[model samples]
Structures are given as C-alpha cells and as structure tokens.
Target: MGPSVMKKGLLLIALVVGGGCALFLYAAATRGLSAREAPSAAEAYATRTFRRWAVPANARLLRNPVPPNPETLRHGMEHWADHCATCHANDGSGKTTIGTNLYPKAPDMREKETQSLTDGELYYIIRNGVRMTGMPAWGNPEDGENDHETWTLVLFIRHLPQLGEEEKHLMSTLNPKTPSEIEEERQEEEFLSGKDLSKHKSTNGRKQ
Candidate 1:
C-alpha cells in the first residue's frame, strides 16, 4: 500500500477511537462515576473487548500444566474456599455481599459468560488479573511458567458447572471465618457440651 493510503487508514482509525473516548467521557460526566450502579451493556461490551485485547496472543494458547484429577480438584477447592470464596462464593455464584457490591460486580462463574472462556483465558485472568476490576493477581510473576496452583484453579473453574452439594458443603467447611463467627461457634460448642451459660446472659442483677 502507498504511504498516502496507509496514512489515511491510520487517520480513520484514530478518529474512530477518539470519538469513542469522547462519548465515554461524556457518559461518565453525565452519569456520575458511581459504583452503586451496574454498567450499561455498551460499557460491559467495551470492558470485555478490552480484556480480550489485553491478554497476550501466546497466553491465549497456553495450556494448563497441572493434571486434572480428584486430588487436584480437592486442592483447588480448598484454595478457592480460603481465598476466592469471599467474593466468588462456594458455588461460584458471586452472590456474597462483597461480590454483589463490586462495580461491574463479580460474575456468576457458573454461567456461560464465565464457563465459555477457554482454560488458558481463565488461567491468565487468575494469574494476571483484569485491571479496573475487583480481581487481584494471585500468582507470583517469579513463579515463572510452573504456577501449578493457578492451573489447578482453572480446572476447578471448569468444574463449577457440575458443582455438587457435597462439594459446596466441603468448601463451606474450608471457608475462612471471621472472629465473631469463630467466637460464636466456640460459644455454641460450649453450650452444646452443657457448659455454663450464665456468662452470656444479661447481668443486670434483676430476676427475670
């Protein structure tokens, strides 16, 4: 192609991109940048497009080195419960309080929107994380190409569609508990064991 033709093509691309940016800025200004509101369909499309573009071409083709087996799934379930369950939920429903409140909100991983993604795409997202979203990079860059845990997570994500009640129950057992929750459990255990309960009762020194 001649220089003039190439220059014209570049100019057109630039104009399109600039126009898109202007429209985005106008929307932001008018709508007010609030995380409480869900993103519009246009915004969602743009975000997905950007995420696709951000992943490296080679990364898209990369395969999980970890073997998918019962053991691998168990380990992935444990890791997910301890770490990801806070936002993603044990069922991959993303229905937790924190997940629902996130801007663009955490996705329901059981749905086609997440399940349709390739294993490599899931692994890449887990390792690197998407910018302007709640996801954080969980894998260390120094881990090189042998990030077994992240690969295991990829397998677990694929298994979300087939998640069982028993699996979810196990994950709930593995999930992290807050101090209050732990304390409540301790008290319940004590009560269940027929331990003294006077300390927990109101101590106003008045007869009921």
Candidate 2:
C-alpha cells in the first residue's frame, strides 16, 4: 500500500481503539459526576494520598462496630436515603443511573469482591471525604454527630450483604426508633462528637 494510504489506515484504527476506551469508561463512571475528556496528565499519574493518614486504597468494612444497635442503623438508613441514595443507592451497590455518570465512579459495597480495608478507614472516608473522587465529608465542626453519622453509615453498610430480601424490603422504610430508642438517640446525638463516638456505640461493626 502507498505510505499515505497506510498512514490513513493506522490513524483510523487508532481512533476506533480510542473511541472504544472512551465508551468503556463512560459506562463505568460512578456517582453523579459527568464524563468528559480524560483526567489531566497529573491526575492520570496520581495515586491515593490518603495512605499518609493510614487510609486504605479501597473502603473497609468494620468488624464489630459498637452499638450495631438498631437505633444507629435507623440513623444510618435515614442519612443514606437522604444524602447517599442518589449515588450509592439504598443497597450500596454504587449503581444507579446517576452514580454511573461520575468520573472515577463510586464504590459498590455489596461486592466484597473488590473491598479490602477496615471500618476505621471507611469511617474516615465518610467523615473526611476523598478529594477529586466524588466522596464527600460528612462531618462539619458544627454538627457534633456528623462523624458519628459517618461511622454509623459505615457500620450499617457492613451489614448489607447478610440482610435478606425481606430485610432489604423492610429497610426501605424501617426506623429503629421505638420510643425508647428515640430517647436514646436524642440523648446520644446531643452528647457524642469526635473520638467520643467510639464509646457510645458498640461492636464497631462486623462482617456481613
């Protein structure tokens, strides 16, 4: 073939391969972020900086969360439904029409297939957020329980896979608040903050 024709053929093949990659990643986008050009040169080479602080590469589920109590679960369910279900989904699959649009994508909790970390790491990720990765920090210095809420969410998440279809259906609207639990919740929310949260709830969480 002529050099000109061969060069044209190679360019077309390159374009097709590049386009396929774009579509593949587009299908993989997580959370609510939009897809566009690929990450910048610096971003492409970047790795998790969270390791400096002991955070893991992937989210970890806790094993013995204190107060795996129903009240905390109720709190987590509510918080997740309002704040997270849009992307992570009520089931934590990180699969949703919205979540799949995000750039780096979201984590799917049920797929213990990909997870490898500790509960503390997951709590830190929830409270401190992962910059540029679409994960948000839950706690502000303002709301005392935001960190508590973060851990609580992680604790609840650890329980996902073990939950039967009935439990999931029930979770669609379950509130752990009996009058007694509500009283405890009201008091706990008023009193807990920072590291102190570790004491009020027990178990820290366990494997699903």
Which number leads on lDDT? Answer: 1
lDDT of 2 by residue, 1-208 (tens): 9999999999999999999998877777743234634455575445444343556444343343457888888777777767887778777887776677676666577775324446767676676777776777777757533457776787677776665676657655543346877766665775764346445455555222
Q: What is the lDDT of candidate 1?
A: 0.88
User: Local error of candidate 1 at 168, Å?
Assistant: 1.2
Model 1 misplaced stretches (Cα beyond 4 Å): 1-30, 197-208
lDDT of 1 by residue, 10-85 (tens): 9999999999999999998999788878889999999998898888888888888888899998889899999999
lDDT of 1 at 125: 90
Model 2 steric clash total: 18
Model 1 CA lDDT for position 18:
100
TM-score of each: 0.78, 0.51
Q: Which ten residues in a row are the worst by lDDT in model 2?
A: 56-65
How does model 2 score by TM-score? 0.51
Q: lDDT (CA) for every model shown?
A: 0.88, 0.65
